[model samples]
Target chain A: MQYQATVTIEQKAGMLDPEGTTAKRALGHLGYEVSSVKTAKLYEIVLEAESADIAQQKVDEMCQKLIANPIVHNYTIELKELN
Target chain B: MKIAIIQFGGTNCDLDVLHVLKDVLGLDAETVWYKQEDLTGFDGVVVPGGFSYGDYLRAGAIAARTPIMDSVKKLAAEGKPVLGICNGFQVLTEARLLEGALTTNEYPKFRCHWTNLRVEAVDTPFTSKFKKGELIRMPIAHMEGKFYAEEKTLAELDEKEQVVFRYVDGNGKVMDSANPNGSLENIAGIVNTSRNILGLMPHPERASESILGSDDGLRVFESMADYITENF
Candidate 1:
């Protein structure tokens, strides 16, 4: 069976981020009063697994191995078993 | 001495990095596609500066998720040397091979100019060519080069002397105003706990030639060569 997993990674808040600042400024120019903005990347993966536990394990491995940086970016894996 | 420099779809500085390794340092080097999985027989690896994935989504964010990065990570885990410059630094942070994250410049602008840096730590193979407290000049061009880490982590890095470089003024003085990206502690570079992997926001390969106004950058690549020759 195959499972779908979504991983989201973002820069930690209070850390200096020039890209987010530029986006926030642009948004303000468009009449948005957002004081700050954070940037993140979302990745969806399709993988095969025998059980939910195994699926979660595979997803975690993916994140640590590639999907997310363990130091700054926090990641949460959402596993949906696909029949 | 085979060295592999990873080349992503949008990487811009692979050639320059290749030049530094092959021409300046007189080492055997080649550019490897990011999609390639094998990294055997290479003494060192470099993730050169450039807008990988066109800096889309975020700098280094997309490239970090590339298929080749897994091989880079595995090589780094085995204590092989990996150096990331500018955009490469962003990729390293995103990949978590090195500590901290690089944010946008403090000025909130894409800055392109010569940056002064102080050697904060010299124990790593990357900085072994320089003396402690030595100041070096290198070019920095990026919109997102600010480095940040948690306070405790920062303290730990200080204790371990892993902080490799910090921004400084022309007079060789460390000051907040000289900081181009408002990086915490004016950090310009860092290394992993083992010190084999290094990530710096400045481009050393760009400054390896005298016509570029400084050859200080050559020492960095040379030092790595020396380290590999002596230790490995």
Candidate 2:
């Protein structure tokens, strides 16, 4: 079986988001009804795991070692199993 | 007079920093790799600038956890002087040796140029060579230099005179537009609450030589020498 994990990283609140600000302003003028928006990096990984527990452990290691910087970006991981 | 400069893999400024300390200031300094666990008998420790771990997850994130930082933190806690420049500043903040965090520049570009800095306090060992309100020129090169801290923490730093340097204009006035990184209160450098650790975005070593334009940075290094002589 193969599992897919996705990780998203976002800037903390009150931290300036230059990229988000620019994007939000542009989206507003385009009539997208975007009030506030923040930018984040996304990573998706596919790996083989016998069980969900093992898959989660590998995903956690990936987040800690490479996917996200715990110091600034907080990450949320989503996992889906494919049989 | 032996100074230890921590050498992380991506630390580009370690050699230049050593040159400034040895050749410019005539001090004995050596580079210590990040894996070393001990930093004994060193007068001071410097964390030079570079994108450690290729700035992989975040600037200074990976390097902060290196074994060398444990000893650096201990030295800083003991009131020994530690200076972090550019990416080194980010490393210090990540290691919790200093307060606040650095985000990307407001311009969203990798800014590299000389900028004006006003010395906000001369009370700490880091800025003793300069008088309060003196304006100095230094080069800043970084994509993430905007410093952010909680409002209460910022207020406390102001009250304690720990906000050491701020970005300014040629007229010696601090203006938001002149703030290259949009740092809180235009902060460019600061000392820890204990006043032993200093972190700043500007490259003082780059300005130590007259040929580089201004030698104002020599004062910063010289000030450290003065502080060491006076105290130790």
User: In DockQ terms, which candidate is top?
Assistant: 2
Off by over 4 Å in 1: A1-83
Per-candidate interface DockQ score: 0.37, 0.42
**Which residue pairs in model 2 clash with each other?**
none
lDDT of 1 by residue, A1-83 (tens): 79999888776555555567789999999999997787777998899888879999989997776666565667888889777
TM-score of chain B of each: 0.97, 0.98
TM-scores of the candidates are: 0.80, 0.86
| Best candidate, TM-score | 2
Give me candidate 2's TM-score against the actual structure. 0.86
* lDDT (Cα, tens digit) per residue for candidate 1, span B1-232: 7889999988899999999899877899999998788998888898999899888756898998777888898888877789999999999888778888787677887899998999988888888889998989999999888787889989998889888999999877879988998889988999989999999989999899999999888888987887778766
Best by lDDT: 2
Task: Give the per-residue lDDT of model 2 (tens digit) for B1-232.
Answer: 7789998989999999999999988898999999888998887888999988898778998998888899998877767789999999999988888888888897899999999999999988788889999999999999999988888889998999899989999989989978998898999999998898999999999999999998898888888877777766
Per residue, candidate 2 scores C-alpha lDDT tens digits across A12-79 of 66567788899998998998977788999888889999888999999999787656655456788889
